[model samples]
Target: MIMCREATKLMSLKLDRPLTRREQLQLRLHTLMCSACRRCESQFELLHGLGDKLPDTDDTSSRS
Candidate 1:
């Protein structure tokens, strides 16, 4: 089983950029055995994508 720390680190790395082949293999192995971590990873990926799709607002006039 992948420890929480390692899973968290992998999660962060995934958010930063595409994983190397070794990293991808490791993540796959970890997820295959750890359903909880897999779910967490999926949630993080969904939330990250959602954040990216959100529009940025610089104008404050609407609030006035």
Candidate 2:
């Protein structure tokens, strides 16, 4: 079983990219026992959807 910190990191990584089969299995097993991670997973899923609607900015763009 993975710890909260590690699970959270994997949760974020999954949002950015496709997790490997091993990673998917590990996270699935962990979440089965951890409601906190399950909540986090749901929250990040919302963020992933919102990201598509947000504007794009780059390093060349100046920050206010």
TM-score of candidate 2 versus the correct structure, residues matched by position: 0.80
Per-prediction RMSD in angstroms?
2.7, 2.3
Model 1: CA > 4 A from native: 59-64
- lDDT tens digits by residue: candidate 1, 1-64: 4576787698889899998888878888888888888899999999999999999877886686
Task: Evaluate all candidate structures by whole-model CA lDDT and list the values in order.
Answer: 0.85, 0.90
- Give lDDT for model 1: 0.85
Error of 1 at 8 (Å): 2.0
User: Best candidate, lDDT-wise?
Assistant: 2
By TM-score, who's the top model here?
2
Q: Candidate 2's error at 49, in angstroms?
A: 0.8
Write model 2 residue lDDT over 40-63, tens digit each, in one string.
999999988898889887966686
